[model samples]
Target chain A: MSDQEKEVTIYDIANKLNISAATVSRGLKDHPAINKNTKKKILAAAAEMGYRSNSFASNLRKKSSHIIGVIVPRLNSSFMSDVIAGIEKVVNEANYNLFISQSLESMKKEVSNAKAMFNNRVDGLMVSLAYDTSDIAHFESFINRGIPLVFFDRIYEHEKCPSIYINNYKAAYDITSHLIEQGCKRIAHISGNQLRNVYAERTRGYQQALKDNHVPFDDTLLIINDLSARAGNEAANQLLNLPVRPDGVFVANDICAISCMQAMKKQDIKIPDDIAFAGFNNDPTSCVIEPNLTTIDYKGYEMGETAARIMINHLVNNDDLQKTQSLILRSELIIRESSLKKGSKT
Target chain B: MSDQEKEVTIYDIANKLNISAATVSRGLKDHPAINKNTKKKILAAAAEMGYRSNSFASNLRKKSSHIIGVIVPRLNSSFMSDVIAGIEKVVNEANYNLFISQSLESMKKEVSNAKAMFNNRVDGLMVSLAYDTSDIAHFESFINRGIPLVFFDRIYEHEKCPSIYINNYKAAYDITSHLIEQGCKRIAHISGNQLRNVYAERTRGYQQALKDNHVPFDDTLLIINDLSARAGNEAANQLLNLPVRPDGVFVANDICAISCMQAMKKQDIKIPDDIAFAGFNNDPTSCVIEPNLTTIDYKGYEMGETAARIMINHLVNNDDLQKTQSLILRSELIIRESSLKKGSKT
Candidate 1:
């Protein structure tokens, strides 16, 4: 058969199932409104028929480039860079190129970047939403076009586009549990843009873990701020001004954690002795900091590689991948001297 | 007059000078074979006639959808990302998108990436050459046309493209003098890819400073290793085995310096007490490390911003910036507790 002859059309599946082209197309992609039995029948028929969608032809007609567009909150961030490096290595090996853009933490910029990528006609997309991005309408164009999209780190609750990320809930719970195990009664939490899913999940983790341990969660201990050195300094100021000082701290990122350490040092508060500390993402800063920060070893590179492969696999091999989309990776915790208030133990 | 009518053409200059068009063209661009007086005469005649050349037509024919291609060594590194962020901000504001590609330390991959960028027809090119990238001939495709090119950080010696960078030699000299002023008798240097101009200049600075200080320089004191954390850790092993221990240490990058510190700590060596340490690039690792690192702050963002502006100025404002090909920026040394060993008693 010719390459075009091998190309699957909605009609091929319809004919095999003795159904309309429209129904086959909708059912193969798992339309929520489709009847359960009919949807299953259509999917099974399409798979059995060995249908190969003419992605290139369809993309060309719709001005879709089969390129996966990615908009990271920022580019130079250590975590983001590692993830991207992973994605690049995977996608390049598969002959797919990612069109990456940076939102730089502004909703206006995020919207503009999304619009630009939409116009560029990427077949599918993956995103780590911006800090202040409340409404996800900017992504409506792709969702409406039946384009598959996924989110990681900072996710959006979109029905059409599934998200793939680590078990932030469990990871945070583990970190908090470890802190509590070390006998931290009054623990402070320094977080990133609360508008993000990663931070929200972490907050929930901290609260739940506190509840589980029978420790009353105090609102005063929660400091909502940007996970930056400057913000960490400001957070330190607030921590010092508090009527009752906290015994431990858990920062969302390593930079913030290290900054808080510096700020605390300025106030003559020694780390791991006056106030034990913990940070997320086993960054270079974790090792650089004295008493070496204890952190959750989040595999940023693996996340990127997996996400890139997911996009490429759907484009090249599996037609049903877009329908069943969420991928979850595991994050591990490494205890170090910073959190070891009791005799050095995990 | 029309745009072309106002343009300087070799034919018009030749007509006025009663010389060959080739001679006029060669003289305008300052070809080496052309006589100095004849070149000056052609230049004067071209100015008087307002003769236009191929630059305008060439640019119009090669419009690349206003995309600026960036080929970096790696995206995750502290310095590379800073430069990229600056480049992205400047270009995004100017309505140009960046297509970023990482070489991943492979010369073959770098070649293919260059080809892809060329085929994609990026309006202009911004590059920081890879570790082992000696032949920049892949860029000839852009130069074959009239594409505006700019290089920042890493560069080749014999290029006419506008290069925006810092005076590596002077910065290295300043830092070396600083070590000397701190009453350092023996200083060991850790270096990176020796073929690179940045490393070469730093090595040169280290040698010159020792000579000028009337201190006998030892060949055994210089260690050439890839400036990586793993490499730095291994270098520590070599340092311990040395017959004579050095009092002052200068590593090429912060990651390496911190790793060296980690290794020294394992060997029961105290930082700033047993040995003073300094590094290049004011990476966040410097701040995170205990006794905070004293090092050179290579301003990546400033370099990126300046490089973008230079290219855009040449592109939009009709300026021939190649006359001033090499642009240098300022670098500063940030001293923290690490190098504060010899105090006010000095």
Candidate 2:
């Protein structure tokens, strides 16, 4: 053997024990098919030879560092925090350490973060794409090295790269339909960058809902921005200045929707009477906002837990690798005071 | 000279050149006092001998992995997230990777996290103590190993471990005094576990302020809980059940104070007219809550930036390690409608 401590492979143990490499591998996992005597002999030989394997190995094998890298767009949001909390709970219980970083909604930071995670030699990786992340080539290194990658929330659907997300299209459709049932004749949409799958699907759902309801779809009714509070305020300004005002507004998220509602209220617009409102992600703010926001309830914590469990199961079993290819969690529309326009729910 | 690649020390390179180890260390950092010729010779010999150093050193020196481990109480809070964002910004610019973990407010989790970080061989460590973490013996390993550790926010002021935090005592005093100035004779204080220095100091400030104002200190007015929203609601219930309701409340944090205020509103209690409220950590919700919350504006981002800068400077300069033994960031009271009973600021 070379003097360099370049990773110990099963071949080294096989040569030492005068057994097949397959036999050494089987012995490492303590396979029942292998005879006890042979397994014991192979395990001793493997230990003597300093054999190391990433997964399914005996005490002789080098143990993993048990580090999981998490990459998200930002950490400031309650939804992202809850997702992280869920992941941390499961991972910490499994005796794994989680290293979290944010992309700050930039592809440059995302690429750099992926590179850093790779260099750190994290056992596995979980990613939630940034708002502007269009290229996923950076993840190819992990895939090539056989390191597992799982994505939650803002995910990309690449083969072998498992992704967990909610049914955004259905959620959006339900929210829009609910607003329509509230007697909103002219409804407007506040969305984010169309590049992201979440926003795109939501837009599609909104359009589909309008078409099904026989409401003329005016391109001017859709406003696309970063969905920041400032953007929401500006959207309210634009709506107020429009020739025909929208009686209802369906926004991408709660914070922005609340900001827009606040701006409209400042202009003496009565909520549910002058302009109904709806948003996604039932954030805490949604509950506190005056005439509470109508929104879609996406269980971020459950999604995070599910994503983490899938990754851990893949890491441990390695047999159900294909089962986690894609998953869609359930979402529900929460009708609140913001959209109860025609009459109070009571 | 040894077969084991147990670090190529400065002594090894110094012995090769028949010079003092101190000279080799000085030359490696490009000390200007060292003669250029001797420095050049030392560099060449160091490169040939495979002598390595930290990240700032040249390529010939085996570069450090440049990974920083950060342990926080939890990740769900906006304040913590902002601080992390600031740390990430500075560290990424310095070409370092951040690995973050949460203790879930448990000392056991914090200890395990510290051990994991130590095993991962992080170049530096930043920690925010968990709610119940009293004994910091877990960090002794890092100190014994001479690895740098910086504590931020929920910090511990050890011998050499520098801590960055706001003046919790002063901030709490200001909030309490403001309530008193607003004609609130009986002011209640809502705080977290007293084990944490942040909460303990804030509680002390609350008591000091009440004493200075000539108000009788009532033990019943001090409600200590986990400070969660649920806790805040329960505290409100307890207050409502009191024979004489406290006219003012000063919560250790904004989220809890907001929750308590919302619960009071639910009971048809008029804000400011019946009860004035103040809180710490001017969280975003502080601005959005009806009758904007009066809070202490603690700059989480700046604190994080300062902490990262201090850590990076320590790593790069390797001088004045003692100067950063502790740091106190500036905090100010933001008077909003929540606590303003006399008249509007306008």
Candidate 3:
């Protein structure tokens, strides 16, 4: 190896600062036994000498990598990004590094990511299930080995793994009810895969809302797809061509809702007049869209922070994960012009 | 350690399959010397026995972690999230794990993240500089150690480190010139911290375009802050209060530009008719906003893929990093209704 490739150690910093190696190590760790002035001098010497602490060696000895792994369906969405930001903030503040990867909403990729995290020996793992992640056998190793595993957002129900999520069922029910209160007799619904808890609960909520309002459930009004922008556009066309056009539309996500609304508008449909609209996940685009989208306002950042905090607490304080098997965060309905029909109460 | 806590090794898999440990290892690695049938059996046995390949041991022997580190200003933005998704795809395809961190646009946090990456012994590093990262000293260790360090988006000039970015100056120049061509004599510019090259170069481009078009550069028309949504709102108020308001506005980013446009619209200012608008980074919200914001369209996913590819090639194939000192990706001016003044040709 070249001289530049050589790893620096405590001895190198000690020699440069004319201090003992033990003192250098203590100073580097900010041990209470070390004097403040000496610690400062030691840190300066360490930086000057390019002496990086060997986390790998320490990890081997301590059996802890001080690294946490995060797996999400995708990173490009507004809600997911906010959640990641929240996770990063909490993880970084706790002096743990983050290993992040995306599943691209594929179960195959999620499985591979999980195996990689397991092989890397992450201190803890946080996951938001992929679109088609039916079986979580990939995560069984973590549970068997006593490594902390957490699920957020698109979660699965497991007795061993703790889950952090919003009450998707109630939020969906609230938004659907609001749309009904605006005098929409026939409401169309756009949702994602039924395998996932979020979409499944939302679909159930939409159905229950119609039943509670004494309105007959129409199977033709429910459109199930990937909940993508393109899908939303296609759903709009489908609804527009229906024999009996729906008076209201509720989407599982804001991105799809916005695109559907845009497509409807292009066809000369008036928002909240011809068709009232409501969506989930109060993405920034919801407010930017014309008439503003009425949606469920859930804090992805807060959900992320809560999930990370739970993992850190279990690892650091030996907190029992089972005590918080299911953590539900707060979410509310945000009514806007998109769902406000004539004579509707604000 | 408890029985469940004990790691499953190749020897255990060999014993279970009644095969030699050497053959088991070869089969597990899919070595050509092993028969296909044996390889399949070995893989099944390994999976059933919960045997995970010891990456740490292999990394020690080869002095390669098969890990890459990425640091960015923040992850909550549409562009950054797209970049991360792109990077994740490429890195995962190469069978290399990723260590991702956010600077929160703080130089202090950036320095610490760098140290953590160094300590973790990543094979290579990619960075998008923070808002206040004035000096490049923190990256010296990577350069000195011959570890490939690449910068994308927000970059710094360094002889050793290569960079991948779009032509910020030219893009800004083109957008400003477009605004001028729309019959705006006095255009306002909203930018972020000047310490960042992305913002500084943009400011220069805006000024140069004004000079070339015979539009006198007014210092009073320029607003520099964090370029946040709130800051954009404040900038709108300040510009609205000016004795002679700018006929056009060009913001460095879409989020800020959208918020500014909304603020002005609240004050009864008509877009394009009253103040033509152009913003950079074609964020999803840009199109969702009223009138559709005219901005620069650059593919963050492509930039991310390019950066990750460069690092992977240098690490895996021993490709020369110096051969590609600065790689400039493509960007285009997207003309939208917001910047289309009356009688202006599309």
Taking the true A–B contacts (Cα pairs closer than 8 Å), what share appears in each candidate? Answer: 0.34, 0.37, 0.79
lDDT of 2 by residue, B211-319 (tens): 9999889989999999999999999999988989999999999889999999999999888889999989998888888989999999888988999998888877775
List clashing residue pairs in candidate 1: B7-B51, B7-B52, B8-B51, B8-B52, B8-B53, B9-B51, B9-B52
> How high is the TM-score of chain A in model 2?
0.82
DockQ of 3: 0.75
User: CA lDDT of B121 in candidate 1?
Assistant: 55
Q: Whose TM-score is greatest here?
A: 3
User: Can you tell me which runs of candidate 3 are displaced by over 4 Å?
Assistant: A11-27, A30-45, B14-20, B31-42
Q: lDDT tens string, model 1, B89-196?
A: 888777666777898866788888876665555668888888888788777656655567788888765456888778878777777777778777788889878787
Query: Which regions of candidate 2 deviate over 4 angstroms?
Result: A1-65, A342-346, B1-65, B342-346
Clash numbers, per candidate: 7, 0, 0
> For model 2 chain B, where is the 10-residue window of minimal lDDT?
B54-63
- TM-score order of candidates, best first? 3, 2, 1
By lDDT, who's the top model here? 3
In angstroms and one decimal each, the interface RMSD of every candidate reads 14.1, 10.3, 1.3
What DockQ, on C-alphas, does every prediction get?
A: 0.14, 0.19, 0.75
Candidate 2 lDDT, A1-346, residue by residue in tens: 2243244578888777788989888998899889999998987765454343442222113324477889999877879988988898788777676777889999998998887776556678999999999879888767765678898888888887888999898899989988888888899999998888899999999999999999889888999999999999999999999999999999999888999999999999999998999999999889888888999999888888888898788776664656767899999899899999867454
